[model samples]
Target: MSTAASEPEETTVKQADQTETPLESLASICTVLAIGLFVMTFIFQNYKIPSGSMEKTLLIGDHVLVDRTSFAPPTKWAPFVHYRDIHRGDVIVFYKPNPETPDLFLVKRAIGIPGDRIHLVNGIVYLNGVAQNEPQAGKPVEDGNPQHAFDAYRDDFPSVPPPPYEIQPLGITASWALDLPNHIQNGDLVVPPGMVFAMGDNRTESEDGRYWGFVPRQNIVGRPLFVYWSFETSADQMSKTSLGDRLSFIGHILVHFFDETRWRRTFHIIR
Candidate 1:
């Protein structure tokens, strides 16, 4: 009877070990999955451009790696510590209107901070009543200009004749139906205490704060540190790669593969 009882006890112990093996495996998997999700949420993230609104500075099809912890504190564990403060002219990424698509990120330059009065005169941008001198504004190119020849051609050859031109008769000046410059005159649209005004470099084509209003500080994700990679949208048009073109590609590729990249724009401290 004693030998029979010991056999049953040993069998029970073996069954418990078999059950514990799966439990241990499950625990390991859960731990790994949790860690992966946490890292993805807080450490770094990737964003893809969806529009030409920030053209010349950013373009469609360009994928950027955004450092999510650049400005905000890492998680809630340490609340008092801030990584960095937002500055004027910093190219920042932010959340868009759609809730279903969280990956839709918009990149724009921070123009107005709290308490700033932004305005526009004619075609120039002004901050706090003073006209901002942006040396980077490459030759005031019109929207859908010669560069976008395809769009121009499509517009000109629409299936239906466009609507009749409306004349908004001003006392001395007659306003015909034509594209107008998006300029703000006098408006006390004060950027709330914890909000900012953002604008794309492609002023004419951008749907920015000028359209949808200010961006809350909480919406900002991160500042773009460097251009890890860049491919010219116009490169494919070339017939054959010249020595100069080959050199350019080699340099760009090297930057793309190795270094902080953006050879010409590398180490270019964001102002």
Candidate 2:
């Protein structure tokens, strides 16, 4: 009788070890998913390229994973965490202040830091009184007139745009441009403390520091880690306002995902 009872007890123990309760299984799944979501929303973020503002380097429909921890200073309790400085030429994502939009995030290259003298001569960027060697400046955009081709407000930094077209400066840039003369020293714009001068890799097409003024240190987001996905969709498709257009774009993506996807760009590291 004792031996028979022990056999049944052993069988029950094995059964309990082999099968998980429904609640236990669900809890495990929830834990895994919660961790994944936390990592996605906090440590890294997914960003879609809406325009060619960062062309060549970051094209339209290119999805990037921005690393949030790189620029985050370590806490005293979390001193073991890896942290690095935001160096020049780093591609960073940040919140650019815009009254129209609530959360306007933009990606650009960091050109100058606090105390760095930044200026542009005929569109070539000079940092600390020296010309920057940026091979990724992209192709020059053609703006109709050959004479004024290199005379946009972007081309001649630290100086107001030539007469007649001088009224183009807007908002914060306009305010900064008004006081730009005070900051200019020997033709270079000295970056104020706690601010950074940022621009886009596609210099000709980018509406960056040249138009907007310096980016504050607090506005600096983390760097772009890699291009996770790249699609051939146009910029217009990104803002599919109508329901039909949105559904159609979704169907198109599902049908032509392989053909329209840029396979080479997937997992490409951003410099």
Candidate 3:
């Protein structure tokens, strides 16, 4: 037994400390915040429906998650991301193409794309000389119903020019009223290059492209992916911007969060 030759066995394995320093923790938090900010600003957006224009599909008080990248212009940096031309029948969110109200954002279905010929007959949309079968489009009330009145300006579109502002100031922007005639050719409204003809699912209720004008390709924000949440909110609630009203509504939401929430509409995908 050569005890002198047997040297003390060396212990090479040691436990490493895993606790994070304050600076490391701060860096992690900053990284997360940066990613979130990028996502919210350029990849996805949150929008709350303020009107019933896209009703049945998107109701007032329905908060939706919009995909901002799908319709965005393609870039050299993000080759893996999907980017496609806006197709007819796609539900789109865009800015109102009105000189007076340039910042108003609206959601409507794409009825016509560039170079497409569009017209309407009896509230039915005809695109590119072919009538589209859209089950999502709403119909007017039956004859004798109070809401059964028809407006040739809306249902017929371009055939009867937008009414005089003095007669009806709510629908049809001033600029559109002036420029509409230039686009009407052979009884069809020809969508110019880089323009989209958009309409609401509720044809009678939606003050869409027919009222304002074509949604410029550059003005499109994105398409709603799904309804993240929905509440029983009135259309006028958006106009109640007073501080007292805001606080009252916040209290009302706290008390009625469970009951007033439209649970069935939660996470409902927008078509």
lDDT string for model 2 (111-152, tens) is 988888887877788887778777788534466845326654
- Relative to the true structure, candidate 1 has a C-alpha RMSD (angstroms) of 11.9
* Tens digits of per-residue lDDT for model 3, 1-271: 4765454322222222456789999999999999999999999999989988887788999999999999999999999999998998899988888767789878899989999999998888888788889887876656775444576788887789877877885567778888889999999999999999999998878888888788899999899999999999988998999999999999999999999999999889888
Candidates ranked, most accurate by TM-score first:
3, 2, 1
Of candidates 3 and 1, the better by TM-score? 3
Compared with the true structure, all predictions reach lDDT values of: 0.60, 0.79, 0.86
Candidate 1 structure, TM-score to reference: 0.55
Stretches of candidate 2 exceeding 4 Å from the true structure? 1-9, 139-148, 161-173
* Model 1, span 146-258: residue lDDT tens: 54332221121112222333432211111211211222224433556887888777765565665445677888988766554444434242443599876886676666664
Cα error of candidate 2 at position 270, Å: 0.4
- Residue 125, candidate 1: alpha-carbon lDDT: 64
Query: Candidate 2 — worst ten consecutive residues by lDDT sum?
Result: 162-171
The superposed Cα distance between candidate 2 and the true structure at residue 204, in angstroms, equals: 1.0
Which stretches in model 1 have alpha-carbon errors above 4 Å?
1-36, 73-82, 97-103, 138-188, 231-271
Total backbone clashes of model 2?
0
